[model samples]
Target: MKHPRLFLHVQEPALAAQLLQSAVVKRFIVVKSSDAAPWSEQLLQQSCDLAFIQADQHSEADYQQLLSSNILAEMDFIFVSDGNPEPWLDKLMRSGAGYHFRQPLDMVCILDTLQDFYQQLSSTQQQVKANNSMLDQFGLLVGSSRSMLKLYRTLRKVAVTEANILIVGESGAGKELVANTVHLASYRAEQPFIAINCGALSPELVDSELFGHTKGAFTGALRDHQGVFAQAEGGTLFLDEVTEMPIEQQVKLLRVLESGEYRPVGSDKCRQANVRIVAATNRDPQQAISDGLLREDLYFRLAQFPVVVPPLRDRNDDIVGLAQHFLAYRNAQEQQQKQLSTATLQLIAEHRWPGNVRELKHAVERAYILADKMIEPDHLLLEMALADTTETELNEVPAGVPLEQLEKAAILNTLEQNAGNKTDSAQQLGISVKTLYNKLEKYQQTEP
Candidate 1:
């Protein structure tokens, strides 16, 4: 009564009848002929949960035909192979069979195995449903541009393995998006994905934030804390702006990467950390090393599988697609739909997006909020990009300007504009709040 129906693809009448006698199998379909293809299709159409295919009872031709049929595609196949099951079991498993059993089945063992299989099948179905729901909400990466295609291919290749990845690009270059895609495609998709910015914390606080600390480790340490490493165990730990980590902390981080072990500050016991590190840095790590900002050894350790996320400016062909994508995203967030005009898209494509995808995203968000009807070129505000340059130059300069000064100016402007709200300033700047604090500290130290 537990299972309403079960299908048995067995030519042996005695075995079929004995199996049907079980209290769980209320309804049964027994295939007694080699040409039982129509029955198989009918069983599938009827939504049979389990299919027992007896290899010994059926002819080789019949087995081959069933295996090749589309009816078996969605079904969970339980193959009952003969005594020496190595060859047949291998073939069946490779051909998408879920479970296998040897001949001369023990009733007790068969019942137990079926119960376990039912539980597993239910769990798998639930997981697939959840995944489909998430995909529907997030939407797939939708671009056919050569750069996007290349990035997609690379992401697929890297997702199957366990390796440290370093995503390098200028700010707004979609580094985090790439990291998410890597996680989604990887074997650890079901595991926790925790992201932290090394550039966001001070040298004194970065260690405790990453590896945690015991109670009373520092002035305000209230209780024993589980840092990002512990939180990201068996999953991914995405370190954004890794080059911003102070040199001293980099040495400790390098040790953790090499040994897969770390201890909380003011604690003697070492904890195992099985996190996959995927670091992203806008700064040139090699240059950072040369400038005595980042440790070279740490850079090498983190760069096990380095990937450069191309800047938006470099992928001009993807602009329209990305713009539409952003507009759709904004529309969903604001609960209103909008479209971009051809002239509007053309203007967007013409600009030099020094801030990269982050800048483009901000642009779209601002336009969405401000536009009364259809989004036009005039509705777009390039002030975030323009604030970095002088008003005269912003109007006169035909070519693009250096981004470093622009970035610095933009950061300062946001800080002042937000009344020193570091979190909001960081959000507007497209950098971590920790990075904003670091910049503030740096500015104070060198202030005249």
Candidate 2:
């Protein structure tokens, strides 16, 4: 998140200079006002989180006018003065003046107060979620839960607009599917839909992969390669795990969004883009910005419409229905009427699916394989918590369990936890992505 903005009405030069140099004050966006400019006029113009006004310095009429300013309703006010504010405390509190303080200020307590004020602001912002709306199906999504219905309702309105969309959700909550739904439900339904995982690409290749490269652009440029934008012209482009994109690459993306134009690498020729941009991240957008994983400016440009997909835990009511849907597809392939046991259904309802829908689908697949007539809870691996599945398996291994088998299982489980994000999987395993890729290839070759 961007730093909380403070409207610091500085009257004393020494305190202003001290505040500017202090480490405590550097945490905020401080906007100083010292001249005789009306506080109400200035407050009306800029968006501020907190207003520190010298209430006693002005006349009673000026104080009353400041309190009457409509902007104060949206802002938290801390009235400052050298005199006692006891007489005006009741009236000040009624007008949204949350705090009052005398001169010889305690800067130490100020930081703690700011933290509390920030929390209040954060709580208000989180009050508007999609769970209050309604719908049963939209594109590839299938769920009867309130959040799923709300998501469907949100997507319907979002798809009509040409503005960019940002989808935020936990891993395996089907953000890409939501992006596809946005495309399919929009006027661009018949157009190409291109999807790429930002985390899956290396830093050096991001530019070439995104904007295309002309033949002989670099040493390994065998032929001209068309990028996602060119391939997805007049369509939709889904960027998954966008927070994992390098900070430098984010600048290029911001430029494209602003201008709707880009030049292929090594070619001076510029191209206009007709593609709709849709980005997704498993992390909170505000936290990602504060952590420097995502750019603030780019975030505002892309998050014109943000759709948050509900995690499986929040939509547990739909778990059985989704499992049956997956099983039906698998059963069709096997040409058999396979079914889940009552115990398996009970376990599915009770267990917390930390990895969300992807983990649930994988569990269903495993159950299908292990059971001939009826899939049981033992086959689902729901006995242990989803987060502990890998650790439990590792700890309970028999004496003769092969190291290669254990290693493969750990790698596969980690990959599932990350929703098949190879870069993240590699990082978690403390191995290079090249090694991870090699092992995956070996697993494919050796599998019976």
Candidate 3:
């Protein structure tokens, strides 16, 4: 999930600095505004999840304009005051305000307020998922849920444009499939579509891999090789888990995006790039920027159009259809046909599917291999009931436990459950393997 963006319009420099230093503030992507520039302009450009406005400093006209604006209709607002409540409070009573905080702010209270805000926001998002007619498949993508249909509509609109795109979703939500759909739908369909996993490559080799290298560029460079950018010229380059890109490589990529030209690792001459970029990441893009994992400039450049793929659990209605599709595809490949029983289909739908669509595909394939003719519930080889119970157990925690500690425990437990396989654990956790490795590294440093 991407971190929520909060706009800070506080006028007092000292108070702004104090809030900026708070640990809880780090959890959000904050956009701080200067007193000189109009905060409304910032609000217009960025879709903020929350806003912290100083009620005392702003004029009545400013408050009235804000109240009339559509920004208040969508995002949550929290009013900040140094002392007693202002008389302007009467006008904002009708606004969908979240909370009010007075000066000498209690960090604990602020943290608690944010936790509740996020919980409410999550619930609201789930409820707002669009409802549409079912679809078994769209291009190569699967799922008939409302979310899938909405995504298809978005793809149709975005594919026609030459604009760069950013695909955000949990692991195994088929981000690659979405990228493929975009490439096929675009004007560059005749050109090659090259896909690269940014997280899987070594940091030292990233530059060479993306921009090509001359012969003897490095110790092992025996021959000249074309990189992804050159190979994908006049086509589309899909960058998966782009947030895992090395910081230095990010600078190079930013230059390419800005100027449409790049130099090879060893060469002085620069080559022009005609390829389109379609990047994907399992982590929240805004959070990645806030955490210093991704460059802010690069994020703004790539995310010209952002499409978020819905997870399998959120599309429960499509589980059976997807399972059957996988089973049929498997049978076609091996020349052995099988059918799933009604009870087995029910069992598949009931499962939480923590690993999303990829997990479901694997489970279905396993059942197809194990079964002779009719696939039963046990043949599916999925622990539906136990997993459902475990899901609940995982969500609950004892009081006074810090959020970071719980997150670490979840990561460690998931890693152990996967037998220390970083890839599997990351998939189950809906994050990238690189992110999992980073967390492990942090834990290692902190261990006493």
- Give one digit per residue, the lDDT tens place, for model 3 in 1-448: 5567788888778878877887767778888877565776666667777787777745566666676675553576777778765655555643434467887777578767766555434322232222221234555676656577556646755676788999998866788889989999888999999988788778889988899999988899999889999999999999988998887789989999999998888888999999999999989998999999999999999998788999888997678877877776667666876889999988898987766776676567546655789988876556532223465444433456677865765575565345345687789889987688778657645521
Off by over 4 Å in 3: 1-135, 384-448
lDDT of 2 by residue, 116-224 (tens): 5553343122222223212234577767664775566567556756878999998778887799889998889999999877876789889999999999999999999
> In candidate 1, what are the lDDT values of residues 1-448, reduced to their tens digit?
2332356776568767766676544333333334635444545455555677666633455455556665444455666667664554465565445667776777677766665545333312111111112111111344444465445545555555676888888766767767777787777888998877676777778878899999999899999988999998888999987877887788889999999999999899999998888999877878878899878788788886678878777777667656777787666665776878888889899988666665665566556655666988765666443336467645642245456544555575465445334567788778887567666556434421
Enumerate clash totals for all models, in the order shown.
Answer: 4, 0, 1
**RMSD to native, candidate 3:** 18.2
Score each candidate by Cα lDDT. 0.66, 0.74, 0.74
| TM-score per model over all chains | 0.58, 0.62, 0.59
- Model 2 C-alpha RMSD to native: 17.0
Off by over 4 Å in 1: 1-142, 333-335, 383-448
Distance from true location, Cα of 338 in model 1, Å: 2.6
Alpha-carbon RMSD, each predicted model:
13.7, 17.0, 18.2
lDDT (0-100) at residue 434 of candidate 3? 65
